[model samples]
Target chain A: METQDLTIDDCWNRIGIWSRGTEKCPSLADVIHCRNCPVFAETGRRLLRTPPHEGYRREWTRILADEKETKPLNLTSVFVFRTGSEWLGLPAAMIREIVPMGPIHSLPNISSDSLRGLVNIHGRLHICVSIGSVLGIAKRTRNGEERDPAYSAPARLVVAVQENRPVAFPVTETRGIVHFTPEMVKELPVTVSGTKAAYTTGILQLGNLDIGLLKDKPLFKALTKDLK
Target chain B: MLLLLFEIGSDRYALDARQIVEVVPLVRLKLIPNTPDHIAGLMNYRGAAIPVIDLCRLLTAVPCENSFSTRIIIVKHQVENSGEVSLALMANNVTETVQTSLEALPPSGTIMAETLYGGVSGPDASELIQWFDVKKIIPEKDFLFPAGE
Candidate 1:
């Protein structure tokens, strides 16, 4: 057969048939006509060859597809926390640890919006970020409508590793963890306006619920430099 | 180009429109000790500590008087060798953004600068626009200078 007439599909078929012969598998020349094959130069790049059996080929295809799909999931882990109305996720790799919001020593004579207060966590001073303040959402007022008995809860801190350092994020409440598959994530639309989106990685669609996953690395780094 | 036009007291000024990320209302800011008077402090902007500069104070030596119109224009200025430097400017009010051309810029006589006063005229010859030389306003020395300097 003319080498020019052979396609990728034909190469795959030949490799499949050669593998079934069990003659220690056919040589590259016998199976793919390596001598005249224009694609032979690129053949060494792929580590795996096509298996002869129909079942094996299907299984290999599924394995490769799964490997591709699961790679991003390995880099990410879901961290569930509460903001205002709903639960959210921060990537687990990004989280440093959770701490309690204790006495925060405020620095005076500075911009009122700068929440660079100190929180003592296990003997180390961690910068406490006011979630509401940072997001430009109104802070829950003491005098405002009393917290709903059902939803009202004490504040908690979510310390995450941002820019390779630890920074604390103050949340109204802390939900637990929720793992995400690649299928569950979706990019936010540009029409969705807010400063919140800059740090958001994507919207994780969990059944009927939607949680925003935060990309806190850059944010934490920026905060760390500011604190310095 | 997209210009983030804003007012500093009654005077209107503009920085490079491309540098502006967004205009946000005054949020709670944490104060940094031992900084200059014009350095109003910093705000937690999407996890970054964006240094806030009182435009009125930085430009005219007038303290920033917060009002309903008060806003923060987050400007991202790139340093030559260094990386991006993000700072916030306190604007009395955010005005409209006008797409303009350099060719349309009015005569240079309409706007002049001294060592301190950096000025540029807008596309409309009638309107005078001042460039906020943020570097000059907040000198690198000041950032490294210890408190009370």
Candidate 2:
């Protein structure tokens, strides 16, 4: 059918999630979700039919009008992540992989609180550890709280390699990569104590908040320290 | 100036990004019969039919390879009498943008007359990039239907 002949079916709102007092769609029993319905997909296509909004070309022209600022050589790249209320980062080179959250099996006779458990990753058994405790960061509290799925990033297992041996650690959610030059690192305060301070070499300036650039040698040393 | 970098055959070309409206991934186009080789086809751009020109075909006589990096750059073309109309440029390896100084770059010193190239510079002192002129690509040659003209 021609695009002009197409009409929107607002049955989703009339019988779907937003239909609180109205009748529920009989298809809802089988389809389960409004997104699964053909009507929903049909309405989504109409978005492409709409013309580009006013000032779109003007805005693009203005943005590209000025010469682009030259970015400094990215000397070091860190994979910044969050845990509880704290924000931490590890050198991108040290991180082996950011795998999806998997089942962590508890081990017997291991009394250390930091050693989480052994996890099977692609047939290889890697010892999972609570890196937060080793770094002195408190347990994440908001993990249980409901978050808007649209905006929230999912938790992932960060597998960091030290030598040939690999270690797995869970993080609330990852913030991708942050690039900075060596000069951008600021000296950490002398008063800072414990493993967090030992592993953190310097503070990397990220906009307003400072990110602790973990010393790869010391941080990985600590992750596998308890076992040895 | 910021430039969009793309490859056509063995040579790499740069286009001034300021004239660009948007860069979209290569989409299936409706072929128009009896048209020139460079004319890719009509694209249903947000309900409006926009004409696309293949940069590879236009320059090297080779159609742009359907690849991941291939894209259609939408721009406002000043068609004579018909006024401003949206035009889509299909090219390959449009993956990166370059930041070059306006004064730092020297003219290519190419002896070819009526060439579409504006400026030329070697990024690594080995690879020479020629800046592609958009105006020359869509000149007042009655490329369109010539109804309003």
Best by DockQ: 2
Interface RMSD of each: 27.4, 14.3
Residue-level lDDT of model 2, residues A1-228, one tens digit each, is 243545666888888866875689988887799988766765664543343333553353344334444678657899998765567788888788988878889988887768989888888899998777778776434573554342234378889887878999888878889888989898889889877788898898788767888888877777777888
TM-score list, all predictions: 0.37, 0.40
lDDT score of model 1?
0.60
Largest lDDT belongs to which candidate?
2
Worst 10 residues of 2 chain B by lDDT: B109-118
- Which stretches in model 2 have alpha-carbon errors above 4 Å? A1-70, A139-154, B1-149
Error of 2 at B10 (Å): 13
Native contact fraction, candidates in order: 0.00, 0.00
Q: Relative to the true structure, how large is the alpha-carbon lDDT of every model?
A: 0.60, 0.72
Deviating ranges (above 4 Å) for candidate 1: A1-75, A112-116, A138-153, A221-228, B1-149
Query: lDDT tens string, model 1, A1-228?
Result: 232222354443355433445443245645445444434434421212221244543453344223233355443568887766655787776777877756678776645453657788898887776554455444555675755432345377778766566677667677677776777689888886676787677888877777887666655544454465
Query: Considering only N, C-alpha and C atoms within 3 Å, which residue pairs clash in candidate 1?
Result: A96-A160, A110-B31, A112-B28, A112-B29, A113-B28, A113-B29, A113-B30, A114-B29, A114-B30, A115-B30
